[model samples]
Target: MRDLPARLRELLLETGYTLDGVRERLGTVAATALAREETTPALRATRDGDPLGTLIRLWWLGAPVEAPDWLPVDPLVEAGLLAVQDGLVSAKVHLQPWETGGYVVSDRKVRPGDPALREDHVVGAGGASANLAQLVSRRPAGRVLDLGTGCGVQVLHLAERAREIVATDVNRRALRMARLSWALSGIDGVDARQGSLFEPVEGERFDLVVSNPPFVISPRGRFTYRESGFEADGFCHDLVRLAPRFLSQGGTCQLLANWLHVEGEDWRDRVGGWLAGTGCDGWVVQRDVQDPAEYAELWLRDAAEQGTPRYRELYDDWLGWFEAMKVTGIGFGWITLHDSGSLDPVVRVEELGQRVELPVGGYVDEVLASVGVAHRLSDEELLGARLVLAEGVVEERTGPPGAEDPSRIVLRQTRGLCRTARVGTVEAALAGVCDGDYPLGPLLAAIAELTDQDAVDLRVRAPEALRPLIAEGFFHISTA
Candidate 1:
């Protein structure tokens, strides 16, 4: 095995084979043999100068190739360093870098163990990866579960942060590849198990659970790496339903998923209903929606580009499946669940028109900040909250000259959370006097005297304006 690399090097030079070309040849050689003999072709081709002998030698090794390596092998495979992985696999690594205890890095493309499958295109680290990474609460936990551990990217990332990490997948090939990638990458202490969802981890619980499941909604399971068995929306539903049992109190489950937009049902309520009585605080952000035709075409192109034939047939099948299920469209997004069951857990639905660049080491920070703020201010407590006007906030008033002293004054925030507040004269006067020194009562008194308004009445109304301004981020209060 040690001499394998040298022989492989020689074969490449003699054949004038590029890395990708060699990988393809190796995959084809491997597919004919047993799983145990998978890497024999590349090893023999390297050892012997005769390419035919090497090919025959691979047959003796018992490994066989079935697919091409759409994934690539570059710096990762060159140094026997990191494992070669797909885009989704790479995205998991990119998303949760902190879990690795150091920065996670990978080439955009790399080769798989099989050679016949030599040329694969990987999508870039996308929004789903970023969102899952961001939703990860950084607090250290005892055990982390990376469900559907494709290429073991999530497992590698989690190994850095969690005391123990377990990665589960249903594909034996993916599991094998993940193990090789793990070894190649030099990431230690990750247990790569093969099973669907939580099957292997039955009766096991974790402090944190993260997944970028095969949530693609398809008519049939075309590709094991990308599609799940639950049919349409079943993958996400099962994940959400099953997560509560595995999560520790106050722990979190963060995932990237695709859900169907069914006819006559709002997507938000559909997902929201999945969380009812789960005792989990849920945040689901729907990033994009594609109609049936568009969705079918997108995945069809994906299949065709991956060298899958029967493009029109596959496209028709996808449409027929969606039509049968009454699925109008596909909704792609992220969902995070915290075990802490606040009476009113954070549930927000917004459309991100386009992708936003994810901040490094900023995901956990944002989650913590939102949780802290949400816990601190619940319901009526917000009414009593006192805040100072933020710096760089300016009042802009626009109206015709002598136009009843202007209809309204617009208070715009220049930093923090971008927000704008329109204020009535009384509210405007109160905000103008807040210099971060006076308490709310004292400031309201002074404003009342200046404007000739009743102090008690001013105090009561003043808080209402402050509430919206503070909440909208037009003003921020000093912690002191």
Candidate 2:
């Protein structure tokens, strides 16, 4: 078992089975079609008898083919990666080529026409996985924890920067496949453990922690990968509450989560309440909202049960549960907690539903830091602080193009969250000239002089108005 991963890696690299190689081989049409779970185009593309083609057929498409002479069939079968029947070979698990040179090992994806997924089925990298990877800060860490590390995708992302990584999962099958993935990816000494959530890592602290946990709000916990056995969104709430205990001071924890929007509650307060006593600066961004029916149908289709005989029964039951629980809607988003060790931790809960830039980890890091800075600074300190307009900020004036003074002035960001702020003439003037050269008090005083307004009143009102812009990454306050 130990030697097989090396041999398999050698074989895969020799056949050009990396992510770019496979995508190039499949071409644009077939590759795009395959992403939509339409297999016919990819099946036609991989009919050739070459090594890469044969690999795609057997492992990627999950199709059976005659054993090729060039490949070492015996070692693969011995590794339990493949099975042979009547002179044909087929993949027992999905060996997917992931980012750069990594491989993710998991159960074969259960497509629309495939058999129902097993209860312990381990899924490969999906949208949520990618989102968590993008959300995590890339700063080097002494130790990292990947909670619920199914197939170990986050481990691959953490390997380059972390000195040590401990991956935990409740499902033994997921831990087994994750070990294989780490071995095949050439990442050694990943401390893999089997336990639910923080149970496996109690009394241990880490510099960073990330989880794409079983956050699906479901009535039944049939699927270990997506559903927690806890009722409603309790699993997510519990995970949030327990995270700060395992985090070293100045460490960070980021995860993808779902929270219910009950009939009588504002989701912001409900989710914010999870951070009350954690002693960490927390940020929750609600990216999407789904009503009861849409949420149920989405997960139902996820298990390949959309067209099954029990489809209606499962669907009805899911909706019934939602209705009985008073769940008006479900909100899906990213929750980031930074263990800043502040005596008074700041927590912000807001919604950003528009499209934003990718690889937002740096943006997240900056936002959390800025939140702490903004929260700690007194009004006098804010006025004395030098500030600069952030990069990618563009100013626009609207409402009658030829008018002497535009009726509306907007400041928009081209990067990060792509947020916008509407400001009055004084704030607009401040934005145009804040280059971190002078303190905000002097700058606003100059703006007051130019706009013919009361300088003292301007100084008092400007700091509060600009606070949101600083939190949203539209401006940078110089701490130096």
Which candidate gets the maximum lDDT versus the true structure?
Answer: 2
Q: Which 10-residue window in model 1 sums to the lowest lDDT?
A: 88-97
Predicted structure with the largest TM-score when compared to the true one? 2
Residue-level error in angstroms, candidate 2, position 5 = 0.6
> Tens-digit lDDT track for model 1 on 216-297?
8887765666677566788889899899899887778888888888899898888887776677777676778899999877
Give the runs in model 1 whose Cα sits over 4 Å from its true position.
1-131, 305-309, 341-344, 354-357, 360-380, 388-479
lDDT measured at residue 384 in model 1 versus the true structure, 0 to 100: 43
Report how far off residue 216 is in candidate 2 (Å).
0.6
Candidate 2: which stretches are off by over 4 Å?
none
* Total clashes in model 1, counting residue pairs 3 or more apart in sequence or in different chains: 34
The lowest-lDDT stretch of 10 consecutive residues in candidate 2 is: 471-480
TM-score of each: 0.64, 0.98
